[model samples]
Target chain A: MEPIVAYSLVLSAVLFTMGVLAVLARRNPIIMFMGIELMLNAANLAFIAFSRHLDKLDGQVIALIFMAVAAAEVAIGLAIIVSIYRYRRDVDVDAVNVLRG
Target chain B: MNVIELIVFIAAAALALVGAAGMVMSRNPVHSALFLIANFFALAVIFLLLSAPVLAALQVLVYAGAIMVLFLFIIFFFVQPGQKHLYVYSLPWQTFFSGILVIVLICILVLGLYMGGVFTAEEHVQSAAMKVEELTSPQALGSALFSRYLLPFELTSLLLLAAMLGAVVLARKEGRGDMEEKD
Candidate 1:
């Protein structure tokens, strides 16, 4: 692989790990949501890297779709977080355990 | 192999790493949002390097500009300031397990990519590099997005519409009959 592709892949790996750590460790739902975004971005990076490496436009097309999905996810996710806060006055993932509330 | 490309890539990669670290470690959600914005910008630079200038522009305009602004607005409007410091490293076991998971995940991803021959494949690099400009040109991407990928493009619009409706419904105030009917 080219140096650029290799380095970009490594960076994507590292960023993805950090995002997983954030999702698992953070108590706040918003931070966890950010971690999810980080993971998605990392995936997009890998897609772009492979797209460049393979000389294919398919990967870039998939990355574009990923971006659209991510946007929709964020919108619905933030709305759910707001709804959770409305009921309990807090947005801690650990605190909001029960489904009924 | 070019010196200028290497330098730019290294700088952007470092910025991206630092932003990820800060976003993960920051106590305040607002600060985390800001750090993530910086990370998105760095990723945009890297995207440009990868010859996907259109993706880079969308990365800046959509991720950094629109999504992050929404995040910051949520942080300001809903998230309480006093709640920031209350959850500092509260889950030790969760952190420990997460650290293990991350290490395993990185190892698997990197080794899998390397051993899968991704790092050794060099036959197409020259040809691919030569076509970099054409790959990301508006005409090329637009034709592909509109022709071959038309179905997905249309589906994405539907998904966005559904999400908008969902958000509006979920965030709306609950009327007196809203919960009573469920009970």
Candidate 2:
């Protein structure tokens, strides 16, 4: 068995789960953003792993593109957070529950 | 089964996991971002061990070199670090509950292995590192990207361009009334 590769894949899944838990469990906006980043990187790790296992560069290319998308996500997300902060002075997810429709 | 490769793999994995844990645990967004960068570096090192130097190079350049800098800049410049701390969860039980959830998730993962993935061991003749030539050569990657993956490649570039525009528009400094009104 290629234990290393398996372990990395499993770890990637574990981290993705952690990131999911972070998003679900935490109520802070910034913390949620961090969790989302964790999830993105977790998925990226899987991409790299599959790329290596297949002996192809496809996963690497996807991972690069994913990084770009993740960066843009943070940019837009942080901007939204800033705008929210400007009005309420807090990034608490619970407090901003007015749009709870 | 070589001692050196084993040591390297274990070390890279350990560093990555430690930094990952720290990023999740830290309250400071800046610290979390920094720890994530550390985790990214460890992952890139592991990619090197897997003989994907191009992937590893991109991991360092695109992840550590570029994206993280964007994160740090936003956190530092957009928000005042000293402004009163804005903690979200008020109850201590929230943390305790999440901890138990992590434990349960781990159990499920272990059970997943027992259920199937080992059922078949198709002989994989190609060594994990089939050829250093495939991984290291820009020519190989270029042809693959431009030939086999041309459509997806162009699509991804367009997607990135769209994302940049969306990010700028949403994060714009002025005329954020819609957001402010909701806040």
Q: Per-residue lDDT for A1-101 in model 1, tens only?
A: 88899989999999999999899888788999999999999999999999987778888999999999999999999999999888877667866668984
Clashes of each: 1, 0
Which window of 10 residues has the lowest lDDT sum in candidate 1 chain B?
B83-92
In model 2, residue pairs whose N, Cα or C atoms come closer than 3 Å (at least 3 residues apart or on different chains), thus clashing, are none
Q: Ten-residue segment with the worst summed lDDT in candidate 1 chain A? A: A88-97
CAPRI quality band, candidate 1: medium
**Candidate 1 lDDT score at position B158:** 99
Residue B95's lDDT in candidate 2: 71
At residue A36, what lDDT does model 1 achieve? 97
Q: What is the C-alpha lDDT of each candidate?
A: 0.89, 0.73
Tens digits of per-residue lDDT for model 2 on B23-105? 77777778888888888898888877766677678878887878788778767765576666565447667778887887787
Docking quality class, candidate 2: acceptable
Q: Return the top candidate by DockQ.
A: 1
Candidate 2 global CA lDDT score: 0.73
